[model samples]
Target: MYKLNVLDKLSFIFIIIGAINWGLIGLFNLNIVGLVFSEPVNLIGRIVYILIGISGIDMVLFLFKMRKSFKE
Candidate 1:
């Protein structure tokens, strides 16, 4: 089994949120983050999008580390 630290867990959660938001956009054309923070093009909403993107990057980097662990 793989162990995830706090940062990993948080990033995974954010990624999940982003996935769900995308699903909503595909199915209903809704934007959850924009709904929560106001306009999708606004600064706070952009920040949220950036954070989610960073979380995805973090997960990709973590996967490389995890692959090494799996081989050991």
Candidate 2:
């Protein structure tokens, strides 16, 4: 089994948050991230979005790592 480190855990959390935010947008036309941050453009919001994007990439890498571990 593959163990998740701190970064991996944090990334997973962010990914879940991102997924929930998207779901809300699709189901209820709500943008939680934008609502929490400033509309149009906000530096802090942009940073958060960037972090979420990075978290998604991290998750993809984590999947590959897990797959490799399983094969081993």
Candidate 3:
């Protein structure tokens, strides 16, 4: 079995949060992050979004690595 390191675990958590936020947005037209950082130009919200995006990319890479591990 493949064990996740610290960065992998953090990336997974962020990705899950991003997915939930998207679900809420689609279902109820709500944005949890925006509500939490309620500013017209919130730097922190932007940073959160950027981190989520990076986490998504990290997950894709992680998935590929896992796939390769399974095939070997």
lDDT top scorer? 2
Q: Which tens-of-lDDT digit does each residue in 39-66 have in candidate 1?
A: 6468988988998999999999899989
lDDT of 2 by residue, 1-72 (tens): 999999999998999989999999999999888999968649988888999999999999999999999999
Q: Model 1, clash count?
A: 0
Q: If ranked by lDDT, best first, what sequence of candidates would result? A: 2, 1, 3
Go through the candidates in order and give each one's C-alpha lDDT.
0.91, 0.93, 0.91
Pairs of residues at least 3 apart in sequence or in different chains that clash in candidate 3: none
Candidate 1 lDDT score at position 43: 92
TM-score of each: 0.89, 0.93, 0.91
* lDDT for model 1: 0.91
Per model, how many backbone clashes are there?
Answer: 0, 0, 0
Per-candidate RMSD vs. true structure? 1.4, 0.9, 1.1
Off by over 4 Å in 3: none
Query: How much is the lDDT of residue 31 in candidate 2?
Result: 88
Top-TM-score structure, candidate number:
2
Candidate 1 TM-score versus the reference: 0.89
lDDT for each residue of candidate 3 in 1-72, tens digit (9 for 90 to 100): 578999899899999989999999999999999999885529999999999999999999999989999998
Model 1 misplaced regions, further than 4 Å: none
